[model samples]
Target chain A: MEIPVKTPSHSYAVTIGKGILREALTAQHDLFTKADKIIVLTDENVWTAQQSYFEANFPYIFEVHVMPAGEKCKSFENYNEVQTYLLKQKCTRKSLIIAFGGGAVGDLAGFVAATYMRGIPFIQMPTTILAHDSAVGGKTAINHELGKNMIGAFYQPEAVIFDITFLHSLSEKEVRSGMAEVIKHALISDAQWVEELLEGDHVTELPEDLLANYLAHGIQVKATIVEQDETEQSVRKYLNLGHTYGHAIEAAAGYGRVAHGEAVMIGLIFSLLLSEKFGKVNHQFTKRFLHFAMENGYPFEAVREFTFEQLTEYLLKDKKADYGQLQFVLLETIGQPFVQKVELEQCREIDRQLRALLAEV
Target chain B: MEIPVKTPSHSYAVTIGKGILREALTAQHDLFTKADKIIVLTDENVWTAQQSYFEANFPYIFEVHVMPAGEKCKSFENYNEVQTYLLKQKCTRKSLIIAFGGGAVGDLAGFVAATYMRGIPFIQMPTTILAHDSAVGGKTAINHELGKNMIGAFYQPEAVIFDITFLHSLSEKEVRSGMAEVIKHALISDAQWVEELLEGDHVTELPEDLLANYLAHGIQVKATIVEQDETEQSVRKYLNLGHTYGHAIEAAAGYGRVAHGEAVMIGLIFSLLLSEKFGKVNHQFTKRFLHFAMENGYPFEAVREFTFEQLTEYLLKDKKADYGQLQFVLLETIGQPFVQKVELEQCREIDRQLRALLAEV
Candidate 1:
């Protein structure tokens, strides 16, 4: 399956299939023939798992910078290291960057490409399930010591290779972690995907062949919203449905305590309760959504531990805030979310309600 | 005088007049109102000089970050510090960064604004003669540990505030340093300015008003080129006339030993020699150009010290190189400079002739 994202500078094709890595990379060579130098940014694990395959298949004498795996490496230090390496390598504007791993590698490599010589072309070869969400959106950045993705740009890639063969090596936990974003797509826009997740085991235990189906479906939903409002101006804020509370949870817990997807799972549950309070969605819709999210390995303790005050502070610091107000993405039903302009007072009320709910739990 | 640089995003007015600082800032309240927060990125010197004046003139509260003043501060460490300050101040997507100093402050702050939140709007409040060149161009970046401006982006400003009152505080050396760029503008494009320079007194200082007139003219020339090709796709490469050898001189002599303008002056002399060798321009044209440049306080030692091989290596590493070939900006006449695609052997021949010329001097 081919998914293309159209932007002002260029158009990108997201090729979804098994063993498309070699072909997808070959396609990139065709697009950037003038560029002979390639920089492949991938984690140690990914390099260990598949570096040789890429080295053999790639039609150029490229350098692969094997970064330490884990989200912690997505720091300013790492970004500087990559910049130093590129500078030392004598990489020019015509050189290309290949983000040949999961979301972390993608974000790190993509940002390096974005700021290197103003901007350069990079391709996304997403390996993990979590990358389905990350690989599609043009949001590329490294995390600051203070916050996650505090420094980044909405720079799109030249192409995205969603190779399911890479997903075959992912652990069960990694697969579950990636499903959080996929579930997020279903909750925000894909009503049919929600039904499919509830009926089938797509979200629970994603099969390799079903990987393309789920990845394409998730990307399509996110891309459609991103296409209409690329800069998160209006409708695109709906994609932050789980992220508002989820990011707070991730930050407060000191990142890597809970996976991004797990925190998002809890965020979705909290958002559901807020939806019910706002009369946007009923109890039945909330129950069904929570059931699907929880059964797919989301922890209940996530919501119980973090106080509402902590979450509120995190949301307040969110880049999405407009004029000091906390912006909320609430659902009208199970599958339709909208951005709500809520004042500080109303946000405090939501925080109070969340704490009360946690006390009851 | 109002100089406008019309870009795809917005039309910025670069005002050049006496005591325009307070008026220029106060007039921009509408733009500030759209921002979630406002930060004035100024050096310690600028803060001491004009921060109080700005605070008194502006109605709303705006944070002023006093950075260490100098070319040394244009590094990733300072860039991070600015990011930290912006984050701590609760800056959001709507935040506006006001760079209120010279070229270093403008480049560092503008780059910070560009990279922060993908990009935020920034206004340029230039306080030096050198900034006439830096202010109009959208190029914003910080120096990497390894190289000058190794990391950055092509981010334009919301407006440019060029208050001539600021020039009253500038030293004679600073004034002469900036005059080199104006001379470059004339050498590259304007025939009339070349005639004016030739007619002017050798070793004679420019009157305050005439300096402003020269800067305004220089800015207009650069602004037109930038407007045609913002990313230096073609015509904007003309602006790099002296920069090819200038960068080499700066790097070899250990930056700050020679002023940027002084180095550019030497580069200009070498360029003329190269032009004469390439049959691009006559000896009379070269001599006249050289005379006017020397009259303006351009240093001769920059060209005297380095071997041709050293300069060639630096040129090879230049951002303007295409497919291993160094592009030299050679003069056609007194006011006509064109980019010449020169190979390494051509570089050797020019260097041999330049050495002979320098020996005679």
Candidate 2:
């Protein structure tokens, strides 16, 4: 599968397929043959699993920087370590960094490569299913003590490799985490896919073709918004459908405890409830959303525990806030999202409804 | 006076004047007027000197982050501190940062601004004569333990305010240190100005009109080269005319002992001698270079102390070097510079010639 990511400098391709990891490596070497050096940045976990495969296949003099696996390691300290490695190894302006793991590795390595020499060529070899969203967007960043992705850049990668063969190693929980982004993609744009996802047996695993189709649909939906507004000047904010609340949940309760996708799953349901109260979507739509999300084993009581004031504080500090007013990706209906500057009172009302929804849960 | 820096995006103006310091306060307000808040990153020296001015003159609310003053302060710890401050202040993407002071403050603050929230608008208000080189270029970075300017980005400023008023209180040594860069500009591109500078008294006071002409000439020469190759692809390497050898002298001597410009002066003389030894220039040309450099009172014996091997190591690790090859910027003739890769043997021969020439001191 091929998807286009729109950015200011150039557009890029996101290629998704099973057992395509080694093939993508070959293709990249062919494309950037003129490059002087090739660097691959992956975590210890990915390196343990696949370093030998890459070393055996790559034609270039490949070097690997093994970062500690997880969100906690995405600090300036790691960024410094990667920079030191590049300098010591004599990586130059002509060098290219291959981000060859999940979102954490991609974000850390991408940011290090982005600012290393004021931007260099980087390719995303996303190994996890969740990265279907992270890999496509040019949003590369690292966490700060203050917030998630507090420091980052909108640096686009040259290409993205979505090899499903790597997905075989993903635990059940990882797959579910990835599904949160997929659901968010459908809610923001594709109504048909949402119907398909909801109709499936929540207990059973998705067939290969069905999963690929969902990933492709999600990519296309995101690609459309990004194509029109690459820098989040307008319509692209729709893609933040559940991130406003999702990021808060992840931040407040220490990251990695609840995977980003898990928090987003809950955030998606909360948005649906808000949508119903705002009269953009009816009770039928809300029921469908809750059924799909609950069947996936998303934690709803966590949302119930969140106080209105807590959410308000997080929203105020959000990047999307305009003149201190929180901007939200409110659903107009299923497969629709719009940006709105919601007042504190309006947000409180939404919070009140969320508490009621939690009582039912 | 205003000079234009042409980037692919848009050509922005750089202003140089007295009392322009006040104008710099609100100059970027239009671009950042809708900002949620404003943050100022400065050093103890600048904060003490100008914090009150900012409070009295600017209509908008602002906060200040004071860092230590010097080249050594551009560290990862400082970057972390700035991020923490911004986070604690609840600075969102809408906040703007103003880097007020000399090169260290600008470089450190610029890197912080470049990576914070991915990136935000930042303005440069340079207060030293040395900043003529640092301020104009979009190169914002921090020094690492292993190398100088090892981590960085090519992020341009929203605007640059070169207030000459600050120079009025500059010490004689500081004025002479800054003249080194001015002399470098003259040596590389303005031969006629070199003759004029040689005829004048040492720049004891840096009178406004004379300093203005010298600054304007240097800015024009630099801006022209930068315009042609904003990212140092080709023509911009000419600006490194003296830096190749100069940085080695500064590093080996222990930083801060020999000011940057003073070291650059020695490097300039060495480059001229190398040009002559390689048969690129006549003895008369080299003699004229020595005459003006010596008359300018820049230290000479510093280059004599370091061996070719030490200098070679610095050049190899220089940010300008592509891969392991040392990119030496040699004068094609006075008023022209060209970059060529030099190996250890070639650099050794050049160092030998430079050592012999320093016998006059």
Q: What local lDDT score does residue B199 receive in model 2, on the 0 to 100 scale?
A: 77
What's the TM-score of each model vs. the native? 0.94, 0.94
On residues A1-361, what C-alpha lDDT tens digit does candidate 1 reach at each position? 8888875545688998887767776776675577747788889999888776667667676688988888755889989999989988888888889899988999999889888978878988888889988987788888887777889887889888887877767776787778888878888886777788777884656566676787798889887887887767788888888788788888788777788888887778768877887646877766676666666667656666766776777878888888787777888877778777777677567657655654553
Compared with the true structure, what per-residue lDDT tens digits does model 1 show for residues B1-361? 8888876544687877777777877788789788767888999887777766666666666788889988766978889998998888888889888898888999999888878878888999888888888878888888886778778888889889888777666776677777788888988887777888778865237777787788889989988888788887788888888888888888888887887877788778778878887646777777776766666667775776877777766777788876566888877776676788887887777767766765664
lDDT of 2 by residue, A99-121 (tens): 99999999998888778867788
Which residue pairs clash within candidate 2? A152-B118
What TM-score does the first chain of candidate 2 have?
A: 0.94
Chain A (alone) TM-scores for all candidate structures? 0.93, 0.94
Q: In candidate 1 chain A, where is summed lDDT lowest over 10 consecutive residues?
A: A352-361
Residue B126, model 1: lDDT of 87
Instruction: Mark the regions of model 2 whose C-alpha exceeds 4 Å error after superposition.
Output: A30-32, A52-56, A201-204, A277-279, B9-11, B24-27, B49-60, B187-195, B198-201, B204-206, B277-280
